[model samples]
Target: MNRLDFLKHLGLLSAGAAILPTNFSSIKQSPFTELRGGIGMFSMQGGTIGWYTTDGAIVVIDSQFPDPAHAFVEGISAFGTGPQKVLFNSHHHGDHTGGNLVFENDGYTIIAQKNVPALQRTAAQNSDNEANQAYAATTFENEFSFDAGDETINAKYYGPAHTKGDSVIWFENANIAHMGDLVFNRLYPFIDRNGGAMISGWINLLETVAAKANSETLFIFGHGKPEFGVTGSREDLLHKRDFLSHLLEYTQKGIDAGRSREEITSRTSFDEFPEHISPSNFLSLPRNLDVAWLELTNS
Candidate 1:
C-alpha cells in the first residue's frame, strides 16, 4: 500500500486506547514552582521531561517513551484545565515521538521538524502497526512558531544532533528555550546515526544556541531538570562540546590502534567523563562512539 493509505489504515485504530504512562511522579510530587510566566516541568520515563506553559496550554517537548505519553497527559491534567494546543516532537525517536497518536486523537495538533514525518512514514510502513501509522501526520520540518498567552514559542530546526530532524523550541517572549533531545543537560548525548545525526554538527548547533542566549534565558532540556535564568550558560554548551570531542578523540584512538568494537566497549576511555557519562547517558555511548568512528574514518 502507499503512504497515504497506510496512514489512513493506521489512524483507524484506537488512538486514545494506545497511550501508556511513563513514570512522572517525581516531578509531579515536587512543588509546582513556576519557571517563568508559569512554565513547569513534568517528568516522564524516569528522566524524560516535558513542559507546561501558562494559559492552560501544554506543549510536551518529547512525549516520553511509549505508554508513558498517556500517563504524562493524565499527570498534567492536575496542573491546569486540560492539555490543549500543540505537542512538540523534538525528533522522530520512539522515546520522543511515540506519544504523537495519543495526543493527536485528543485534539492536540502535533508539530515536529519537516523530516520527522518522512522518518515516521518509513517507520510506519516497516512496523505496519496501528500506533506508528497514527503518528505519521504529526511531523514538520524547518521551524514553526505559535503564540500561547503572552509567550511566543519559536521552534527552529538546527541541523542534526540526536536525530536528523531534531529541532529546538525558543520561547522568545518568555525568554525560555526547549532544546528537545538536543540538550540532554549534563548527560552523554544520544546521536541517532540511522537518522543522519552528526556529532560535530550537533556540537556546532549547541554553540549556536549558546551564542543566542543571554543570562536571563531559561533552558528546558529534553532530559534533566530545568535550568532557570543564567543557569544554562555558554559553559554548559562547552561542557557538551568537550564531551563529544573527547569521545570522538578516544574512539578514534581505539580504532587507530586496531581495537575491535568489542575491545573499545570493554575499555574505559569514556569513564573519565563522569559528568556526562551517567547511567542514562551511558546507554547511548557505544552507539554514539560507533557513529563518531565512522564519521572520522570517512572524513
Candidate 2:
C-alpha cells in the first residue's frame, strides 16, 4: 500500500479519532535513524519525530503519541547517559503533543510557542480528552534559542500557517530543521482554518523557510507520501508552496465566475498537483477547496 493508505489504515487520518486512547501494547517500537551529526528521525504513527543527541543531553522535536513516545525514550537510552532531555512541540496538534505527557512525566523540559497551551487546552476540552494532554511548561513568543552541548537549537514562529502556534525547530550545527506539520510532503495537508490556519500566510512562511536554509540543509516533514518519504530539501517546501498558491487561485477564479460553493469544492484533482491525491477522503481536494472558499469569502 502507499504511505497515505498506510496512514489511513493506522487510523491516523481522523484528527478527533487520534485523541482517543490507543492500544499501546499493539504498537511496534520504531527506531531512530541518524540523519547527520547525531540528529535523527523516528516515524511510527502520528507526526514524524526529530531528535538530537548531544554529548550530554538528548533533544526531541515533536512527540507522536504516548506509546511511540515511550518506545522513543527507551530506544534513545542506548545513545548515551544524557540526563538532560528537552522536548519541543512544533504546534498544538494532538498528533505532535499527545506524547508530551510521556516526556513530562519523565522529568523532561517541555517547550513550545506561547499560543500552544491555550489552543491545546481548547482542543482537548472540546474532545473531553484533556486528561491525556501535557502542556508545555515553557513558552516563547517569536523566537527562542539555547545550547544543547555543542549544538544550538532554535525555535521560531512565523505567524499563522498550519496553525496559530506552529514553529520551526532548527538544529543549527547539524543543518537540520524539523518542520513539524507545516509541511505535508506530497499528501493533502490538514488545513485547520478554524484553528487560525491561513493558507496565504502558510505559503509565505514556506518561502521564508526556503530562503533561510541552504542547498545542503535537510528537513524532516511531519508526513509524506511513501514515494516521497518524510525527509527532504528546499525544493520540497517550494512544491507545497506552489500547491497552496494554486489552490487559492483556482478557488478565486471559481468565485469570480459566480460558481456555487458545491461546484467549486467538487473538484477531484488539480493538473498542477497530480501527486497530491490523498487516500483519505477527508483530506481530499474537496475539503481543501472548502477551506479555501471559507478563507476567500471571509466566512
Best model per TM-score: 2
Among all windows of ten consecutive residues in candidate 1, which has the lowest summed lDDT? Answer: 11-20
lDDT of 1 by residue, 1-299 (tens): 76544432232221112232332233234423357665666543422455665666876666654466676666666666444657777777665666677777666777778788777667666667545434534555567887777777788988877778988787787677777667666555566676788888888888888889887877766553222211365567667777888877888889889988777655434666665433333345765677787777774
lDDT of 1 at 239: 72
- lDDT score at residue 114, model 1, on the 0-100 scale: 79
Question: TM-score of model 2 relative to the true fold?
Answer: 0.92
Local accuracy of candidate 2 as per-residue lDDT tens digits, 1-299: 86545544455463334443344455454457888888899876678889988787989988888898898888888765468889999999888998999999887899999999999999989989899999999999999999987799999999999999999999999899999988888888889987899999999999999999999999999977767888999999999999999999999999999999999999989988988857477677899999999999999
Candidate 2, which segments miss by more than 4 Å at Cα?
Answer: 1-30
Q: What value of lDDT does candidate 2 attain over all alpha carbons?
A: 0.87
In angstroms, the error of model 1 at 243 is 0.8
lDDT at 170 for candidate 1? 79
lDDT scores in order: 0.63, 0.87
